[model samples]
Target: MSGSDIAGLIAAGVFAVLVALLAVPIVKLGRVFDELRSSIRTLSDGATPLMDEVTSTVSTTHEQLKRVDGIAANVSDATANVSALSSLVAATIGSPLVKVASFTYGVRTAWSQREDSSRPSGRRSR
Candidate 1:
């Protein structure tokens, strides 16, 4: 054959080898696409139930939070009432008890002084 014809034949052979190499990657890509499609279908099948469960749990949590808020308000009101009652009792009862204690101490001291003075100093009994 002539040099130009031989060069043309070589070029055709190179083109065919390149086409064969590209075909392998194309087949691998098709298999990857098929696997991706299957995985998407599986995810879609499970998503509905998972979404339902999440929504239910959220609603339950919201209701429990509301209950806790109500309980906290009640506890706050009760604490206020108890504090006011304690202050009132202290004011009403604490002052009288203090006065009585002071009066009793004064009386006991005066009686002791009188008994000591009635005894004669420097007089001995035989």
Candidate 2:
């Protein structure tokens, strides 16, 4: 009815209009937060399975590496055994074979020298 009362009413109406205008962006912000939450939930849901698969893959690789380590250890042991066996065979057979070969060479050399001495002037007819 008065000037001050009319001005207050106009101010309240303007405030209401401003609230209504700003509520559009607030509502849209709420919807964006909801979409972001849904996307995060979806990504977590997908990533759980991917992480499980990665865990299983790592477990499988660890198991395979353990098997490979065992195989490598066995190969190493076998190689050591082969090396020891070769050394044993060389010690057992190599010395006697060398002695026998040396004796054979000496006999052959003596025989050849005797035949040469029997020939005239150490020259063979051939």
Candidate 3:
């Protein structure tokens, strides 16, 4: 063959080899795109159940918090009522005791004053 024809044949062979090399990367890219699609679908499927569980848990937590708040309010009200009841009981029971104590103290003071006046200051009583 002539030199120009041989050079043309070599150029055609090199072009074919470059095309084959480029085809391998194209096929690999197609597989990578397929894997990406499959992973996205799997992630989307998993998110549905995860979101449902989170929603249910949040709703349950809200209900429990409401119950706890109700119980706390009831406890606060009960504490206030108990405090008032204790004060009332103290007032009712303590007033009579205080009056009795004052009356006893006054009687003791009067008796002591009378005894002191009846005694002669320098004489020892038999």
Candidate maximizing TM-score: 2
Q: Weakest 10 consecutive residues, lDDT, candidate 1?
A: 117-126
Which model, 1 or 3, shows the larger lDDT?
A: 3
Task: Show where candidate 3 strays beyond 4 Å.
Answer: 1-9, 98-126
The CA lDDT at 1 in model 2 is: 100
Question: Residue by residue across 1-126, what tens digits does model 1's lDDT show?
Answer: 999999999999999999999999999999999999999999988998999999999999999999999999999999999999999998998899899999999999999999999987896877
Expressed as tens digits, the lDDT of each residue in 25-69 for candidate 2 is 999999999999999999999999999999999999999999999
Clashing pairs in 2: none
Name the candidate, 1 or 2, with the larger lDDT value.
Answer: 2
Better of 1 and 2 by TM-score: 2
lDDT of each: 0.96, 0.99, 0.98
Ranking by TM-score: 2, 1, 3
lDDT of the structure predicted as candidate 2:
0.99
Worst 10 residues of 3 by lDDT: 117-126
Listed in order, each prediction's TM-score against the native is 0.66, 0.81, 0.64
Candidate 1 residue pairs that clash? none
Enumerate clash totals for all models, in the order shown.
0, 0, 0
How many clashing residue pairs are found in candidate 2? 0
